[model samples]
Target: MDIVFEELDYCETHMGDLMLRKRSIPSLDGKIIYEVKLGEEFLMSSLFHDAEVALSHLGLDSFGTKQVDVVVGGLGLGYTAQAALEFPNLRSLTVIEGLSEVIGWHKRGLVPLGEKLTQDSRCRLLHGDFFELAQSANLDPEHAGRKFHAILLDIDHTPEHFLHLSHGGFYQPEGLEKMARHLHPGGVFALWSDDKPDEGFCKVLESVFASVEAHLVEFDNPILGGTSSNSVYVAYAQ
Candidate 1:
């Protein structure tokens, strides 16, 4: 029999009723899955992190052989951040997370890859609202007036299906333009969406970015016992 172990660290964020839990499923056997929820809505799960990792792989791949400085918004389970560090030439990585408890999990080595991410000298985890920071001229508050080679985000379900209303603004042209300002020339902006690419959103990105592309990443869903897909939106900064 598989045992499900869960604990709620804390709740009552700006978003409301946030909970972090752990589970072991029959399908996963010995593997433990970490999950986060806002109210009744399931936000992220460790079991379904293929697209999160792919966000870094596809975004960094476009940069080719250059040593890159990267920023990852949302550090859930640290999959995306861990993926970003996989590149050998990665110079520095900044993971900006909204929830302080999530950041603590990594520093305390509570999750499987937590120690790997926290121990890396190249990575820094800061607590803040990713949406607000992304719209500012500086992506990282600690190091103001600095730009990055790539910025990968996995915070929301999609631009249209935002986790919070406050994030809705950043998906638009004006807000995205602000994010673009902090990117080095030819820097990459990649977003992980639970839904397929939105044509209208792509149009919005094209207006601010030099080029834009959408990629569908396929992965197996252990719960559904079938293949599932998500979209990766990449916008290149000039």
Candidate 2:
């Protein structure tokens, strides 16, 4: 098969240069892949999204089968948001994406899950800084002070390794407390991390939430010829 690569879109933002691209790798059976990059860092790829899907399942599963209002911190290929809608009990999903370019990829059908997310009435892709919105009393712009049953975040690589220095505060106790206010009682907050589980961060979550658990999500890494893992942290409000 002929090798194919294309840069779908590119734009500059306050954080850095944001880009969306699609390509097919001959070595990997020429499977088409969608990728997002921020400056030097590769934000997400369609090729490996097991953990993203796991973030939704592990988070919402805590609520049992009750209808849930969910807020996803990052849109990244729409995997997390799309997975959230898979739950029959999910009443609504609000995805907060900091870069409009990322959201445009989905709106323009540049990514695989784009149309699925756009066509679904339950999902709303809102352009805003998640950290900033998380501090607010509401995640949905249309509904002021509206609380949610779950908030699944996949923004930074990890709580310790932030995409931006400003994001560091959100991992702190004060920041977590502010975000917790937006969740309904017994609601859950879940996060995806590229790094291994951090005991210190779990302690911080334990401080604000009634219960906390960190799950290790492992998946096949075809490119690397082995399994890679990500961590998901779930915390329940009192």
Worst 10 residues of 2 by lDDT: 133-142
Clashing pairs in 1: none
Across 167-229, the per-residue lDDT of candidate 1 in tens digits comes to 988988999999888889999999999998789999999999999999999999878888999
TM-score of each: 0.95, 0.97
Specify the highest-TM-score model's number.
2
Tell how far residue 194 is off in model 2, in angstroms.
0.4
Q: How many residue pairs clash in each candidate?
A: 0, 0
For 1-238, candidate 2 gives per-residue lDDT tens digits of: 8888999999998989998898998988999998889999998888889999999999998677688999999998988998999998999999999988788888998888889999999988899999988887766767898999999999999998899998999999999999999999999999999988999999999989999999999999999989999999999999
Would you give me the overall lDDT of model 1?
Answer: 0.88
Q: lDDT at 77 for candidate 1?
A: 87
